[model samples]
Target chain A: MTEQETIGFFKCLADKSRLAILKSLMEEDMYVERLAERLGITSATVSFHLKKLEEAGAVTSRKDQYYTMYSINKPLFGVRIIDILGEKTSESEAQKEREKAYREKVIASFFEYGRLKSIPTQRKKERIVLEEIAKAFQAGREYTEREVNIIIADYHDDFCTIRRDMISEGIMTRERSIYRKAERNGGDPEPAGR
Target chain B: MKNRIEEFENYMRSSAEEKKQKIAEMVRDGRADEARAVRAGLNMYEVMTALFGAALKKTGEGEEGFSREFHILKDNVTGNWKRNLEAAEKHGDAEKVMIEESKLETVEEIVRKFDSLF
Candidate 1:
């Protein structure tokens, strides 16, 4: 695991409920209801923890008839702390931190109480603003220009400038006045309603 | 048609206490099954109301009026479920007891889920 993944893994495992779930799975692969009964908690709580454990790679699940059985990922548990700490990072951690700091600085400067005060003039900052605005529109869903404006208008009166900037920066795509949030990597577009 | 719409409006506006009183009267009259059914129906409304409040809060449109009403309905509904569970047990009806227990459990889960959102 990378440093971030390792952090996420440890953060997920730090929870008492999740540790209890892992302990339960250590004994046997159990379904949600059974785990809930064993722990004396509700099934919903068990499912919630299971989702986090699954994301952390601490647990794996498989379908068994009508129930999904969860088991501890023994290999993940076997991984050493020293190995994770000693691993080489593919990217510079400092550079990533600097970029995040810069993004936050830009967002903090331009936004006030969830509304944009003014459009950023600098191309880089403008791109950041446009990307943030694009989050309002659902990915893969097509929207009319009017619909886009109505959504954007909630943020600022100058929706036209922000909307135009989004298209120019390729943060969004427009076809026949219909707009869709653009995929960042020019990858295959997501199927609608996914 | 207008009278029916007005009746529904009045029903919707009626407090949970009024409905509970009616259900209590039905029980006092020894109409246990009918009372149980009416209570179940009222509990369904409570569940729906809580779910609606959760949806509103989730969508960032948690109006204060709705929040107040939601709390009122939740309080009444929780009490109603507990009473149902007790009644089922007293009547020695295993199936009804299970149903009431499940409903209570489910509602508690939903309430916890929504409470965490804030």
Candidate 2:
């Protein structure tokens, strides 16, 4: 199943009434009123849950005479949870876009004319600012402590705090008095000289 | 047996048709008020705002306390609303299923009432 289908399937199972209906259906294919009677819920409530189950692909129904008979969808029940949760789809792309936009927003909020206004208290926001400052240093080249201070000071007056934050956030690495930008691949910072 | 996903898609498509047919029958039979009430009940913003307002009032928070409470409430209610809206939009064209203007106006009126409290 796709992400949306997986979510729908899990959401369908989350409700007590729906679970009861499914349990009843598992025993025998029954009509809505019969299921409602067995579960001791109102027929209307049973119908509501059945519709949700149908939408989630958890239940199937067929028209028999004047009544619609409902039954458990065994194949859907057999679908592994790992398969449902592990499937990648467009939703993942959409989520990535949202994260990118949020990162941009945080960077925009904290930076003014390529300078950070203040260190963000939130770790996530601070990481974005530190990464932006990290761009001033070359990935493979080392800088003296003084050079690091000058580069970070250009962005914010509190160079020591910014430099320390960079090191703490893993955006940059410091060894002795030397500093270098950490190599980042897919947002994971790799320690320098390692 | 039908493919589960395809079965669901078909079921939703047919359900929408059935709803439209029900509404058409209601109109033809001169029960527009009942239909309108049902439609209004289905309006997410109206339903959410009403529930939020009730919960807010239940807190008994005065103006001094309302802002902090409102922020907490807004996060949860808006998050759920956006998720529901996104899911609905994904399944069908949102524009086609858009709520009527008068109903929206009513929702706005309800929100304005809450705004007055803060």
Candidate 3:
């Protein structure tokens, strides 16, 4: 059985009525009337719980002498529990797969639903970006106004602030809203010379 | 603006993995301190997971809001650890689970069933 079916089984087992039924059934199989009496629940309620447990692969009912006997479904239990609990020697090893599909939703709301959120500062290692943006300025090739904004914005959400920092760090200079390296070197010229 | 949750979770998992390996090596080499540290890590994982659960609003019976799907995985893994170490104690593997059983209450009891490991 799949995880949902397994989960369904546990959820079925979660109920008071079903648990009372299982605790009763652990001794021996019994008729529906006996179950209702032992559980002190109504016969209809007992039957209802039985059906759910059976659906959960927790129990099985079989017609007997003038009454149906309800007992723990060891075969199904072995299949589901052992797979998760990793038990071998289970009887249902070669049986057909029980495809129990529920609406399996993976609700990963990544805080990116409606607005453009900045990647948080905790994830930012400024040293790495400082080095990367420093490379954005090339030999005597100053960046235009928009280029500086884009470069700073790439590594940080607060571009204006980071731009100020870069200026303070002597990495770049701004004039007439454009930016350039404070002084471009032959600047460790690219080895491939491209 | 630090994503404390993600960092905390990753740090917890890798930290647990390291402890697990350390204990296994201890088992091989008969180093008892390694086993003790491993037990501590498992207990820490359990307590942190419970803290996460406590932060969430109770939505239904045992259904927690503000919790992630990874909680289930963590639950199963810790359950497996308890089961294994309990069996280990049964067979004279170590006293790690016993030490943890006294110090932590992270493993919530199964409904209607009560035990230290539960």
Per-candidate TM equals: 0.45, 0.32, 0.29
Query: Which consecutive 10 residues in model 1 chain B have the weakest lDDT in total?
Result: B1-10
Please list the residue runs of candidate 3 whose C-alpha ends up more than 4 Å from where it truly belongs after superposition.
A1-132, A184-194, B1-44, B47-118
lDDT of 3 by residue, B7-116 (tens): 55566577667767876775565434335544665666656655454544343224234344335544655676677556544543323433444223324322111111
Best candidate (score: TM-score): 1
**Range of the 10 consecutive residues with the lowest summed lDDT in candidate 3 chain A:** A102-111
Top-lDDT structure, candidate number: 1
Tell how far residue A1 is off in model 3, in angstroms. 59
Ranking the candidates on TM-score from highest down gives 1, 2, 3
Writing each residue's lDDT as its tens digit, candidate 1 over B34-104 gives 35544654565466555554645654444445545555667776797788679656654444554576567
Docking class of 1: incorrect
lDDT for each residue of candidate 2 in B1-118, tens digit (9 for 90 to 100): 1243234335434544555676577557554533453364335344544455554576653445554665566556556545544544454422212333224434444445445444
lDDT of 1 by residue, A1-194 (tens): 75666887988887666788899999999998999899885564577678778978999999999999999999998978888889887567857856866886898688755678798878899887777777777878899989999988978899998888888888889998889889762343331111
Task: Give model 3 RMSD, 1 decimal.
Answer: 23.6
C-alpha RMSD over true interface residues, each candidate: 19.7, 14.5, 22.4
